[model samples]
Target: MDATPPGWPEAVRPPGAPDWERTAVAWLFDLVPPDYRAHEVLRRYPVLLARFARDHVAAGLEAARSGWRTVRVELADHLPADAMAAAMTAYEREGARLAAAARGVAVVSAALRGERWVPRL
Candidate 1:
């Protein structure tokens, strides 16, 4: 795992747990569209976040799981592979954008909690 440098920003860590990146990614993925994300992306996020946490800011895994569950419910009827693929591509792009925004929110939340900031190396 990558170590946080001394005096890093508190926003680097997520609220309510030490595994901040997992929590943050989970939270960010929640904002994504349900149909595209539930099946195509949800399964991959945990592993991806695990790697991300090793190298970057912390995230929220529970939030991601909840988002996946909601997405699955929203898209109960599965679509053809072609349509699913297209939708998933769009969702991934949007999800990345949303993740960045969520990161900002995580940072702010950390500050509100009075946690120390740690920069990702």
Candidate 2:
């Protein structure tokens, strides 16, 4: 456990939470797509918000039980050994997929809520 929270923005720390960073981080991974723009998702996809929350929380709990180390090992085994560029490309694509999903959720949420001023990502 980190004594001092790392890579946490001062803004997102919940008020009166003892472990704000941990709380926020767990929120990001466990909740609907943890990012600064997630608030936008809340604004747009009003209908799916409950579903996303339920599924995401379940996934988070399962991931915690399984542990990250095992997941990392599985990911490593699937990477291309011969072509470094291909491996990098695959890595980038997967990251983009996650980002796109987050963006989609945010955009849909915002539209549903009829939000006017969405902050720039």
Candidate 3:
């Protein structure tokens, strides 16, 4: 009976479930830098925290993509073929992870902003 969209983070309960917002806040905090937890405003404002998480995830995704694009060219002479292959693999994995995180953050942020999801036919 879970109504959450695909890519919804397992750590965040479905919106409107008991203590969901608290769970969401905790999940969102995990996406941002550790230093972000020190900001009282972010702790007090879940919506803002969600925005921060979204931005952080987006930046990470972009960074991974950029690295993937340039790593082979930038390090071709500096590293062996095995190391280059590993760097490409790392970037690919990170891009996928951040893409999922971005999706989860988007839905969580929408929920925090009072937007509810209705089932579609």
Q: Return the top candidate by lDDT.
A: 3
Candidate 3 global TM-score: 0.96
Clashing pairs in 3: none
Model 3, runs deviating above 4 Å: none
State model 2's lDDT: 0.44
CA lDDT, every prediction? Answer: 0.47, 0.44, 0.92
Poorest 10 consecutive residues of model 3 by lDDT?
Answer: 1-10
lDDT of 3 by residue, 1-121 (tens): 5598777899999998999999999999989899999999999999999988888999999999999999888889999999998999999999999999999999898888888887798
- Please write out the lDDT profile of model 2 over residues 75-121, one tens digit for every residue: 66665665544555555565554444444334333433443332354
Ranking by lDDT: 3, 1, 2
Which residues of candidate 2, in runs, are more than 4 Å off?
Answer: 1-46, 49-80, 83-85, 118-121
